[model samples]
Target: MGAEQIRRWESGALAHAVSDPFGQGPLPWLRGSENYFDDTGQVVPWYADPALARSTDGGTRTADDVHRQIKGFISTGAAAPGEAVDFHITVDPPQQFSVDIYRIGHYGGDGAAQITTSPRLSGIVQPPPLTADRTVSCHHWWQSWRLQIPSYWSIGAYVAVLTTVDGYRSHIPFTVRDDQSADLLLVLPDITWQAYNLYPEDGRTGASLYHAWDEQGCLLGEEDAAVTVSFDRPYAGAGLPLHVGHAYDFIRWAERYGYDIAYADTRDLHAGRVDPARYRGLVFPGHDEYWSVPMRRTVERARDGGTSLVFLSANTMYWQVSLSPSPSGVPDRLLTCRKRRGPGKPALWREIDRPEQQLLGIQYAGRVLDPHPLVVRNAEHWLWEATGAGEGDELDGLVAGEADRYFPRTPLPEHESRILLAHSPYPDSEGVKRHQETSVYRAPSGAIVFSSGTFAWSPALDRPGHVDPRIQRATANLLDRICKRD
Candidate 1:
């Protein structure tokens, strides 16, 4: 279909005029509800029924069942409006399947809005992945179904729900980006997600940058992990990347407040498609540990140019990686991280004389063996305003998972001012005492850099049973100040 025609179809204008095999129609909130649209007659902010989350049936039963049933990956991690994206799907037992597209956002706490649904299409089991040089890549030469993104679709993170005839399902996440400017840009850690993805984790063939199965069916550590990983495969298990929910949690909270924000993948940063300076602030919302030279350079340059930076989780920008093309000659399809220092090889950014603390204001210390309370420090700071938190006040279980801390001896950035927001003590895996310190600083360019210094921070914003009003307010305070929205 033509671009304009697709745009009209997606906007629900052509829904009444033509028969839509894809089931494109008015949104649930718009049916018999005129108030949902703005004065311009456009849908007001695009919300979904909260009941949709409870009713969605697109989850895989188990890891092994992922590939055995139905699983897929998009041809690209991010696409712009009017671009055609191909879906590479595989279904065993040769059945029929359909794809339900959803734009992930707040959506009235439903967390997603259904964009469209494809008709039943034939499904076939694709070829097995190729294992070479310790990399398992599914350069699946399977027939692909292409979907042209409608020009009117809002730019955001999206997922394609793949469901088979007999009730098997999986998900594929991608981003739709644009060149428009906004108050803040949320960068999805897709590179880190792919780094940890051990697709087809069936004990024998699955491999990631962190772990892989040995000949005796035992999991190997990083020393034996795959040196190269491919994006030509689906995510392991239910097709969702680990720690991706952290990004989603922040999204739900930020969108709930009606914050002006845009979205992009990490790859977009590396390719220079996204000029971080165009936005007032750049927010990295999850476990963004892996970094390529170009990615690091771009972000650092942006920060030096007076653009604010926010890291909501710890252990960011630790490992150095390199991106290359796939066997089919697609750029950046293969990610290689040697994790070892050599004359000319990839290694930890710290070992290369550039510590993460220089950019993040804190560096990763160690993993948190158990949950610990985050003790308030510098309570009078602007970030803690309206949070009702005082000196020594503790937020229970706010410091857990991985954590970061300020190192006086490490190379640090030259800043106009700096503050330690939280200083909480926790035990490492070896029972050694360690302290996690949340930090923030103002660079010479007047750009503010804030790091939560704990993996649990984002979860505290929107995750059920973990959300704390104090944290929610503090986060809002930070974003408002950086984006100048307050």
Candidate 2:
């Protein structure tokens, strides 16, 4: 088969495997590509509306006429164990419903096994009144159920399985985290997910940062785009909860290997709830394109304090955002940002004199529609230690998506060594071919930061797929030394 044909097959197989949360068998394509790689990374598809059927477009629903007779969302998007959380429900036709909570994580060969289950709480769903935004309000729905998280609950991602009598179901996602420390911190980009959630409430076009409303209904531009998105609504699509394609891949892989890790939302960094000094390293996985002032400052401080970082995805920290409290006074429930509207607004953090290149050792180069070659440079670097990679060796299919490039900015970070590990070329938005770089550097604070500079990094860890063993070993190498440090 031709190269293009091979990539298409591989991409389809990977997508198929990841879209299933109940853990199906591996896709038959590219079998034995890696003898050592395991295929336990399948995740349940997280939909914005679990009641809606998945549309062919991937991000939208298949049946627009389908109305959810019963649906609800959690009072909070995240909470700690022993904390009582309320699940507000709205049942159409006045029916009975029940909820079962499950903690999502890797359990052996299957992806995302329901590690824990809570006692089902039954209730009657009532109609909810529309809010000022024309969306459903939890207030009128006096029919709500509560669940006190068990102290034994692990720190990670969770989903509440909401089922109505006679077999209708939906899911509500939340994070279970606390003020603990670990060898590594995995920050989930929940903000990015909420920003893109076009939950079709009130029958207008789906509302999200990328869309706006019109006289005819919802349109696909920023003209009527919501500058502020609330976490109060349910996510649309297969509910492949956000970051499943991006960050969750790494989480699954890391768990398979038993990495010493802790999970938290990126908001924790912005709110100063995370102590970076407690961990040897912080990992930003796939499409981490937004940041707040305090979040950036905290990481910079952590770097100076000897904590390392790894950016396993591209186009990171490209925009700046501000967080506000929800009606409940829960901090970070509302994320605010006005993109492409100019200065005085929350412009790209780079426009505010803080380019991400200064921190990432690379800049947002652009994205790729076609595949690119990941050419190894200076393979002698310790990162290429075990898998036997060499200078100028091309690792196929490793830089096929969004990519970054090395561009030293003013006020450069104090680094002892900066090395380009891989150079991948692809066409930019203008159709002009350009190369992206993956780099590693060490700061004077004894902190080392590695940038994969491509969105393909995490996917390279899955198997019977497009994974490269060399890349996996290289990743393990970085984690080993970083975690071993004092």
Question: Given candidate 2, what's the lDDT at residue 120?
Answer: 51
Which regions of candidate 2 deviate over 4 angstroms? 1-66, 118-143, 201-205, 213-218, 342-346, 408-411
lDDT of 2 by residue, 301-369 (tens): 999899999999888888898888777676777777878764575468777788888898887877766
Tell me how far the alpha carbon of residue 265 in candidate 1 is from the true structure, in angstroms, after superposition. 0.7
- The CA lDDT at 186 in model 2 is 88
- The residue pairs that clash in candidate 1, if any, are none
- Across 107-174, the per-residue lDDT of candidate 1 in tens digits comes to 76666779998888899888888888679887765755898999999998888877677666577889
